[model samples]
Target: MLSTSHTVRRATSALLALSTSLLALALSAPASAEVIVRGTEGAPLHEARPAPGAIFPDEHIVVAQPSPSEVDPSFLGPVLLMKSAHIDLEKGTMTVPLRKGRLESGELVWSVLTDVTDENLANLHGINYSAKLAYGLIGKATRSARIEKDGTFVFASGKVDFKPEHAVTPGDAPNFFPPKSAQPGAIGDADYSPLVQFENGKNAVFNMPMVAFDASEETLNAMCDGAVDKTVVHDKVTAICPRDGTVTLQMTLGYTFGKPIFYLSTEANDPVVATLEGAILTPALNDTPFALEDAAPGESAERIYVFVNGPTGIDHPFRQGVNSALSDGGHGPLNVLGGIPTINLDYSPIWRLFPVLWTEEAIEKGWRTKLTNAIDIENAGAKGIVVSIAGGPPQAVGFLVNCPVVYRIN
Candidate 1:
């Protein structure tokens, strides 16, 4: 379990790449039950810019609240629905990690308006682009909501009033978290990222380009519209909406997942073919090992085999079977510990200096192919897969965000 020390130790090579001492035991399960604590500590709401010509209403949203029932959805759709009073740009720059995303689909609606003069009631723009964003979600997502111009971000959650078009019911595009709740599932454990390109205002994009309007206003308004910044969801969550109303646009951005890249050396000696697939992790295989001298009396005394990760149906078998040559009759590919006995990922600063478990440098090189497929490995020694096999594939192996980083101290 993500909560157990044993689980904190072994698992997928790619998952091991995400491991950090700061990673709480909270990551024990794939779909952890909803955990709701009182008080809004991390949930900070930012005020919304008043809709076009509308005056700021006093009690627009007298009661602002994130419904007790939160909604965690996958990274899809045009905009990310949120309930915020006022987002602190300082916070966004200070604590915000570099979020990644990409553009997947949708047309960019760009337009220029011939309306809107000092005292004239004319407001129309030109050109607009609808950029569908696909991403590996990063920060905490806002859920079931009822917002106001007062900049109130609230999650008015209930049994989940879902409509067909709403992004949290049946048929809604898949995203990072589930529906009607913010209990922190893989949305926190996993990475909802999309491939990115340097084009927009900030850094990179997920995988697609944002809907850019040649005129500007059209793009800006569409961004703040419900179509763009109106929802946050995950896999378990579909579309949901008890009602609807029309509104103008504001500002926006989108995302997508990029292709994975790495190099591999096969038995055919094919010049280490470069492969592009999902994300990669070092010590590719579970049963894989590194240390020249296998730990004595079994390394189990330290409570091992804690966590696991990676894609399905991939085990290079470097830790055991015929693919292994690290003595102990284990698999070969994944470079387990910091020892010269085995070859983990082709590149790793940790492998060169430390005598520990895993490192980021190694996994970034695409070594998940050598994962040790199993449920648990208690006192399993360096023989066969050294990683602990908890239950099975469904619960273990997963995409990038689902996979975690791992580490061990000497």
Candidate 2:
């Protein structure tokens, strides 16, 4: 759980993201849940512009020139939703359907958008593509699910408890190194995980958010309408509506390959890590490891880049200000999410936090502050300019987080 002040700020942000009717209802209610509305953070979204193009004769060559219009979703362009989900950029809220399914034991499984297995479904959902999902087919990394006659998902396993109260108390000022107490609001059972390998002959594992367990649709809808306690929703859930069959969640701001991005923080294997990322602490995920190299065959893991000596302060052009070795009192190093698409492509909700430590010599020579590109930072490590914090007490603790990339800011 966030401090009271943080909660208030988050609530205020959520209130601002909602419509007037919702706002009025919130005022009438003693308390209302909040969401972390995104979109306008880090940098402004640029208008789509036409790129210069050149035409080549078919007889000579058929080359497709790079067009500005070819930009990916986020700062690139609008994403088409195959599902009934709606993303409102102005409100920084994405209202996606409150998808429901069931477990083999007849336990209810509730979920939400956006990732899927099929490429066609990906286009329809406006989600990222992950061919690696095929690898999850025969592993402990994925849970099994089947589709019912009415299109409801029936899972073989996986259940979550949204009742836990989340709270986190950062370490005393200066450098909030280790939080005093950290508790994730929601928790999952031994069988629960986001990676779902549908037994419906689908070859892809649908990496989506599992929002609830064994909860009736009617109860969820009532919670959405504020007729009942909203705690039934995850702490990260900002708003929910059964009428619209949509649930709005909060997103965290970060950078991916030097580009500002937003992603959903859902679960973390470590409690402290969960608190820091505003995610649920799913001990069930303890089955996963910190590095993919150590994972069992077919196990899924993606790298989440972090800098140990990046520039500090909010004004620096490349300022992430997450250098743990530095003494600026800023806590939690800036986390880089996902891979550089088309380069070393592997995008999944599952992530392994990888830290880049600037060598003392490099720090002495002042070589680690302003760098931003992922390749450049890794290259610095390869060149002995920096090193991994392996085999020693780290400047900052590293842990895994399940944060699905949502969109880019700039």
Candidate 3:
């Protein structure tokens, strides 16, 4: 939910002042007069004199009045009324009701400035003469799992500490294309755009964190050789010698947008060759083609391409292609240079997962395993071999790997 720590206090003070001013104006104003309220776009969104007992939704109305100096001299002493209350138009004032059901959406500006000159009346017609209000929603979720389960995992016994490296809240997805009748402000859809008619609600995107694990140096070395055994107990003895004789680890898949993605992190300087299934994954973009056939013996392969946040010298083929496509035939300012439209790409700091082949020995093993669908050799080598998974971001999911078991070597 949106934080209201300061909004509550601030709105309270403003409402009290507004009520007092409104009461004073009502006592001095004419008996009746037509009053209208306009939005920032100059559209007539509200009018005075709601039916008796009519209740307005809370948090939707904004009340404000222009200062006497701001108003034209010919329209001075005009009676500005909203609902059953009057407003002192002489002061630069604004308010939002703390209570519910007093005014409807866009009705806070439903005011009357009595005895207005015909010439000065045109000055009060535009949206600049009123207050603007906006409305929207936000949602979020989080979950985690270990490598030993197939579905969502419950944190039952172990003491686990989860740390997020990036901001989890999806930033505001502003509608750059607002209604033409409204100001070209950030929020809502364009007046004539078809997206406004769409029923599905909008969503904010967020970058979730990936789980980390630790491993022993011997186990890491064994993994580097392209062959290792999966251990049930996950102890030091199992790291050095696999009694299970299988190069697979039981992982708990957490909640994800699609399939689970994985990545391997070694010591900062000690780079390890990594491959997903049979394809080489590179962290940065270059002339290097991501093909398994091109990998040399003992060479590390990277299946996923990494792009740093903000503008950088790093070249990302995927991001570039998307940018090019938008520039070629996209709508709004995004079609022009330096104006990229809002697109939720599968890009974030969290590293994706893929079955990594650390050593050429592992590739040479030619294990026809269904886990990765990678079989250089006709015969399958290991039983119960499980391949790594990949998933997209802006999803609400958590990953809990045996950190000590996966990163102990590092």
Candidate 4:
């Protein structure tokens, strides 16, 4: 008979293998039944006439031309009138051009049916005609115009002088992390530091100074009325509440099989709290001595903590999959992080922590209250969770605020 530990290891391995196989099958499923081409306006366009010798086996080509108004001129440099277009479905080729003048009256906007997968269609959605015209110019003028999987040219502009200043390349998208081989189920390991321990429904108090937020009358008023402005400055939101009152917020964290559970509450008369939606937070090791303020006593409000992240925003594939799986009983897309090669498992339990920031609309309108008793962590598995907090006091009087907290559970 196998030892208990050995049996657990075997079971974990089998489970991971089964999960991987299921994921592969789901990814390999066939595309949608029909192919359609619609412009940004949601209207169907005319189909493209294939070239006499164009080759497409068991596939067709779909095409559409969006009006110049539909395109964002800031990203595509100068705007030009679309003149002509052609697409070869079998060859996986698209050719379009934009002349320096206006399109003639009664010009036909064409569309075609193609066998492209839905994933490719999603990436191609809202694609500007000017960008397509730029790609055509690059293909004709440069030797480095390699077409990407989504039918757009990569960053290799070659000798093409038409590269736009704000052109978006494939690198702009979120980079996924590779999946790791699941290890055997074991008790607490030395890899993760213990942050909180819960026993008999009580948590071991771990007191840390809370990150401060600037307290202002504007912030307080915004909070009271349920409005918090999301004005971004330097990729950060800077709104502070006056510290004229006292408030305390607590987040209860628990874990089972390497997943997280969160319960949030506050002691203020008017409770204002924020918790991440569709993400989890883990402690960042090697950071300075950091602790969340367990209690806040009203005093002078000058400094406030702000949340910061990348300008283009961050994407956590595992968290996204969890969110989708909770809504529907199926795993979503497989986001293979960095190509198909060596998988890194070092960043599995840690994420950069930040405060919840508000948007302009939220600041203008009174803040909305969002309270929850528990978070579903069944689908989190062993991947790192990146939590995104929402539902904080509005912009004016920002006194006691509640935000998401991270903890490590064995």
Q: TM-score: which candidate is best?
A: 2
Ranked candidates, highest lDDT first: 2, 4, 3, 1
How many clashing pairs per prediction, in order? 151, 3, 33, 60
| Better by lDDT, candidate 2 or 1 | 2
After superposition on all C-alphas, the RMSD of every candidate to the true structure, in Å, is 25.9, 17.1, 30.0, 30.7
Better of 1 and 4 by TM-score: 4
Q: Candidate 2: lDDT of 402?
A: 75
lDDT score, candidate 1 = 0.19
Q: For residues 1-410, could you state the per-residue lDDT of candidate 4 as single tens digits?
A: 88999999999999999999999988764322111222122135643322112111111222223322223322211111111212222222232221111112221111111111122331343111111111111111111212335543222111101111211111112321111111111111121111211122121111111111122344334533224342210001122223322211222322222222221211110111111111111121122121222122211111122221111211321222222222322222111111000111111111112222324443255331111111222111111121234344312223222111221110
Model 1, position 303, has a per-residue lDDT of 10
TM-score of each: 0.18, 0.69, 0.13, 0.18
Model 2 per-residue lDDT tens digits across residues 276-354: 6657666655555335442344545667766645665544544553434133433334566656333345665677776
Location of the lowest summed lDDT over 10 successive residues in candidate 4: 334-343
CA lDDT, every model vs. true structure: 0.19, 0.57, 0.19, 0.21
Cα error, residue 261 of model 2, in Å, equals: 1.8
Q: After superposition, which runs of candidate 4 have C-alpha atoms over 4 Å from their true positions?
A: 1-212, 230-255, 258-260, 263-410
Worst 10 residues of 3 by lDDT: 332-341
